[model samples]
Target: MSTLLLRLAAPMQSWGISSKFNRRTTNMEPTRSGVIGMLAAAMGMSREDSLDVFNPLRFGVRIDQPGTMNRDFQVVYQNPDDILPTWLTYRYYLEDAVFLAGLEGPSGFLAELEAALMHPVYPLALGRRSCPPAEPLVLGIRDVDLLTALRQEEWQASSWYQRKAKWQNITSLEIVRDASPDESGYAVRDVPESFSQKRRLYRFRNVIREQVFLDQLVSSENTENEQGTPKEHDPMELLEDDDVSIKSQNQ
Candidate 1:
């Protein structure tokens, strides 16, 4: 199976948790159900459409920039009047966040999704309709699996953000991915079953969390053979074998 890559960078993104009445809260990371919904929208699938196509896919994400949280107060009333009672709602968002998301599936299915995203039937958004992504969200397909692709993908943090990170000496990024049956991981109720408006259903999915040290990006451009041509190699083979490396206590 191959992987489809996405650069989910936007001024504002909000992957809301389960319905929380008037207080619509958001998860720290992009949720599996939220990403599935975005893809369904790109293919012009209605809210009542089934999400069987996504069942075979493995999802993963890396946080390039963990943006700060924000909140907004909104008035839901269509028309304002003294006769009608005032109604209000609160929504949360992650400002200036950048995320790299990967979806692993059959080569053919991933290709189909890539094409659909490039020429989306409906408008594509990072999370909500109001929060549209920057142009060209699709980052093409990768030949490797989901986890490895995310581990080797280039850093997508904004230039200013990178500069800010320098002051703090930040050198690692967090990765969250679907865990296999044998792997022990925490559970989050984020798998979408039915997207029907009347009944938005979800199931728990186990996920593994780890941090990868990003001292520098590893790419073919920087790696060359004796002939001066580009050389391709599996980055994970060159990196550590452990799930993740711990930061030094001295640092």
Candidate 2:
């Protein structure tokens, strides 16, 4: 199988799974349905078109930069009359996040997708229409499986983030991939049945989570480990530390 890698970095993204009326939520990572929708748009496939063709492709995403979540408020007026009340809604988004996504399938099919992504028929969005992705979305195609490509790929986080984190010292990254039902994994309702806006449909998929070591790109730079390498940059390492702080604040 061949893998098509995508650099999914955006200023704002929202991958909602169970969002309803006034409140929309977001997942920490990109969702399968969202990725499929973007692919469909790239190929100029309408909502009524069959997504089954792409369903068999193995999908996976590596979190290169886990961004912070923030919420926004909106107010909508129902009627022109001054007496009418306003509707309040809250939307959540991931700010400045970056993900390395992989799609493994037949070499020919992946080649077509890689081309389409470069010259997409329709505009692409991260998750919502308002959220446009940064340039260079098409990373490249690899002659390897989804998991291997995801594991071996270099970090795709923003340059600023990498410099702030001193990525040279990082050894590996974490990845989550679609797993078969027979395998032990987390269940997520992101599989798309039909993307028709009028009648959206979805199913479930099993996800296997694991960590992959960074390649020589990182190790080579850190080989010296000399005093010149500044130890102050630690944004990536601060992820865990910030998480703990948030949880503690909640408690």
Highest TM-score against the true fold, candidate: 1
Query: What RMSD does each model have against the real structure?
Result: 13.1, 11.1
Clashing pairs in 2: none
lDDT of each: 0.83, 0.83
Per-candidate TM equals: 0.83, 0.81
Query: Cα miss at 109, model 1 (Å)?
Result: 0.3
Backbone collisions counted per model: 0, 0
Give the per-residue lDDT digits (tens) of candidate 2, residues 34-59: 99999999999999998889877999
Q: Worst ten-residue run, lDDT, model 2?
A: 223-232
lDDT tens string, model 1, 1-251? 89999978777899975757678888888989889988998899998878988999999999989999999988767455556556788999999888889999999999999998988899888778888886437878999998888888777677678779889999899999999889999999999999887988889999999888786455423432322521112236545755454665334
Task: Name the 10 consecutive residues with the lowest summed lDDT in model 1.
Answer: 224-233
